[model samples]
Target: MPSTVPDSLDGWWCDSSTEYAFVGFSYEVTACQSRSTLNSEFKDIRETFDGRYVRLYGACDRTGFYDDVIDAAWNNGLGVHALIWFGFEGGSEWKDRRDNLIDTLWNNPKAKFVTRAVQFGSEPLYDYVLDPSDLAGNIWEFKWNIEDLGIPVTISELAYGYQVRGGAQIVLDSIDVLDAHILPYFSQTASTGDAAWKDVNNDLNWFIDHAAGRKIWFSQNGWPSTHYSGVEPNSPDAVADVDNEERYYKLLESKCEFFKSVAGGGVGWFWHIYADWQEPGYGLYAESGKTKFDFKPRTEC
Candidate 1:
């Protein structure tokens, strides 16, 4: 059977949980903030964005969280790339968690319909949570078991991780898709405006050259609308304020078009976030639930 996931890499990374205080890389996993809020966000995403796919960081467990997101996305005519959280302290339970998540989705008609792909984990190598060899083993096992579900499987990682690590190569070999996170903001010389577009394209090219012909999907990419310094001392500062955020979005949109023209398709790009949260200034929407940038790309292609 043909895959349900789109070939195009146009999507958004969405987080509905309000508990993302960013305390030690953790967040509360609620099914959703509220019914009305979830509904509105899904609707806006469907109507406003050109793409129909959204990537969620977690499968949201079996509670109201997973069901609500699936229901909202399906009702809004959107698809999801659901991720299974890996790399917890006692990571042995990941297999069980993965099984439960798949079973949950398989049983839920709405979730099964909206879910386009299953991403095994997000940035496992970057956090040093798992060794490359071990992660590859887990991915191989998960892919083998989940292939019967008829959904594509992949893992998310930094573009550089694949170049320098063993697990990334294993992941690339085992999965149907190549999901990478290319954030220009994390580069040594952080880029802004048009320069940002160039930086991202360079990153994209690097991945393309190294991906060994696998379909590439940018699982996360975006510029923060605040001036907050990143985790490391030399990290790039986020673009300050709403106006610059709009500029950053336009630049990225243009770059996406450029990529499609040159790369000949079979790639995907998702912005880092759908809305702002406790991370200070990374959201497209402010904490007040208002859009931070009223991005109106000139070439609406």
Candidate 2:
């Protein structure tokens, strides 16, 4: 809720009341410390917004601080949906940390109002090599954990944007919901199977068909100011280059519309108003307080 959010997109879906309607923001939990810090950031977000719900996701990389961050967000009146297991995997303190975090969040009545996500691994299918057995077993384990914890679980992955067609069915059959992640930087690469936005749509449609009565969410999708290697920062030409930060913004806008079109299906953006995160040029708003995208939507909202 810092003073770095756009005025558009507020109440865009006020009249919507369908299963596919979705409009929410996402925030990394441990980006800052103290309840006030979180509150101020999100406060800045909601002040200009209305209607669209905010889905605060506890970034799982700092699994150790999940509870602390969740407690802060909740106390500040930030609605949290999808408690992401930021970097949790099959064997990483699987039982204790997972259970404890779920216990902490679910015990609260308000927390139950927020959608829950139990990410198995960060891009588990791509980052790690899990054959059918391993993949199915890990998914089943996470599913059981989700059911036991009494929350819906999603499998969040980056390449799912392209592979969601076949991959989605495989996952949907095994889990309760499929969470697909589409990063602008790597989304067009071969790993995604198809780089075209239309292809991503096709994959999403396929998911709808095969999801049975289950749900599907575009869990993570956003653009970076620059591409890998930090290239194209100062390119002279106007050609589309993944390394160009400006180009990333343009790509993100178009992608946002596409995701928005599927709002009823629960699509959540990856970042809220940005802040420096031990990296250069990633936050939606640079640490300098200059907003990166003039229209960076608020995930806190």
Say which candidate scores most in TM-score. 1
The C-alpha TM-scores of every prediction are: 0.79, 0.64
Candidate number achieving the greatest lDDT relative to the actual structure? 1
Runs with alpha carbons beyond 4 Å of true place in candidate 1: 1-31, 58-64, 87-93, 229-239, 262-264, 296-300
CA lDDT of each prediction against the hidden true structure: 0.61, 0.47
lDDT of 1 by residue, 227-280 (tens): 664443134453455666567667766554454443323455666677667355
What does the lDDT come to for candidate 1? 0.61
User: Which residues of candidate 2, in runs, are more than 4 Å off?
Assistant: 1-22, 30-32, 49-64, 75-77, 83-91, 129-132, 138-150, 159-170, 187-210, 228-273, 296-301
lDDT of 2 by residue, 141-171 (tens): 7566556445556566654532533454455
lDDT of 2: 0.47
